[model samples]
Target: MKKFTVLVLVVIMTLGVAGSAFAVETLDTNDMQQREERQSKASNRFEAMKEFNDEHDQIRVLRIERNHLQIERMEKAGVIYDLLIIAWDNNETEKLRAAREIRKENIEINREIRALHEQVRTARKEFKENVKAGDFATAQIHVDEVIKLLGEINRHNNIKVTNLDEIISVLQ
Candidate 1:
């Protein structure tokens, strides 16, 4: 009778241990599934942000190109102004005609610059709106892109614009 009771108790303890082990395994499986789901969702979010980042980068490039064009237009205007001054001082008919032609070109360049500026303004507004709506990660991406663009602009123009510095500061 004593041996038989000991055997029964051993079997009961074995069953209890097996039951707890199974429960732990089940919990681990559920935890792993949850983790995988979370990871998938995070990946989707990152992919969407990447697409937006690309679009924003393209817009930034367009803006930088427009800014460079504006600088070219300003330079042309300055040249025309100098020619006009020379024409007035020297009473030269050829210089005056050349100045008038440059003025016409300058007017056309000014119109194009204005249109480009409006487009840039629209892009900036959209970027600001996105940042304000709690898309800080994407905004940071845009900020980095703009910083790179500013560096390129400075290199091309050989001068740093204070307004660009202000913009970088605001983004930071």
Candidate 2:
């Protein structure tokens, strides 16, 4: 009985050790390296966003941080997603230079959006003042300018959206 029990224990131990060794052999270092690279890239993106001359810069940074946290919570694998990332890492970079170009475009549009917002805001204030002062003709002109400025804002927003879509295509 003792001999049989010892043989059974040795067989179990040997099988467990062999199985674990196989698992270790199959594991790769790419996952850790990819995670670190992604962290650094996100930090770079956040810094670039903070350079914007707008009140929304903080909000942009916070949104990035929030998303980063969310991504961290998810399973970030390497080889499984490598087929897609490998292609993206190579060829798709030229389209938008790996998000850098698109990011620049978005920054420029954000500046334009800010300028348009200021114009529309002051125009609205002056429009109300003119109305109160019984300057109907001037108030009507301000209204027209406000409409034109708002249209410009919308156009810039569309450009930003397109830029974002381009980034998403290359990333995913």
Candidate 3:
């Protein structure tokens, strides 16, 4: 009788522990599902931000190219200005929001090129005017300024191209 009683007690204890373990397992599964959902949401947000950043960068490139053409035309006309309106326009609030967490220093540098461009335009215009007015000495001063500005811009453009090439190489 004692042996039978002990067997029953052992059986009861085993069943109790197993029941509690099952309950804990269910809770753990629920927690895992919740964690998965949160991770999915975070992943979606990251993907969306990356997509937006890429599109914004494309638009920036287009604008930069347009501004470059304008600069070329102005240079031919002996005009210079550091206008970065193209960069400003390409940089909408959405672009800023999406790009805040990404590597954006290169884009920023390209955008800032506009300011330098405007200064060059001003100097070029003065030089052209001096030349047309037959003020050789004044025109020569303006020419020197133009040369200096162009040199700076050329160096900057070379650096930009090299950086872009490096990035492309890494991507490839």
Candidate 4:
């Protein structure tokens, strides 16, 4: 009986030591791989985020450049519109001086401009009134006359400009 008990105790002690050693080995090898994989995935995610942010910033820069170009174009259009208006006015002044034999820088240019402006204002006011009165025919006539006056005053007479109205429309 005593020998049998000693043998059983020794077997239990051996199994306990062997089982603890196996567990320690498994934890070291397997858990090291799991920890390393987790770190690798985290690094990959960080790299992907950085790439996405770089693309986003590039898009913002492109949008700013586009806005700058649009602003420059609009400003240029405004300047051209103003210059064309001045040229049209000068053409009218020249026509008056030559037709009426008015002295240059002496008089009549400003007065002529005022009279012509008044004509345009009267036409426009009549057009508006006719429209409000539902007289579309009269309104159309007045508007057509206004267009004729503009054409006469602002004609370039150059084949290079086949359509002057379109230029004014776009610039305006």
Q: What is candidate 3's CA lDDT for residue 105?
A: 52
Clashing pairs in 2: none
Computed on alpha carbons, the lDDT of every model, listed in order, comes to 0.59, 0.64, 0.58, 0.56
| Tens-place lDDT digits, model 4, residues 66-131 | 456446546655665685676567675543334233223223334554565577679879966766
Better of 2 and 4 by TM-score: 2
Candidate 1, residue 32: the lDDT equals 100
TM-scores of the candidates are 0.36, 0.45, 0.38, 0.30
Sum up the clashes in candidate 4. Answer: 0
- The 10-residue segment of model 2 with minimum total lDDT is 72-81
* Candidates' RMSD to native: 15.2, 26.4, 25.6, 25.5
Report residue 129 deviation for candidate 1 (angstroms). 8.9
CA lDDT for candidate 4: 0.56
lDDT of 2 by residue, 26-126 (tens): 66466777889888767655653353224244334544654553353232323214534665667655643666766788788789879988998998799
Off by over 4 Å in 3: 1-103
Model 4 TM-score, all chains together: 0.30
The pairs that clash in candidate 3 are: 80-120, 80-121, 80-122, 81-117, 81-118, 81-121, 82-117, 82-118, 82-119
Model 1: lDDT to the true structure: 0.59
Query: Which 10-residue span in candidate 3 carries the lowest summed lDDT?
Result: 76-85
Better-scoring candidate (TM-score), 2 or 3: 2
RMSD of 4: 25.5
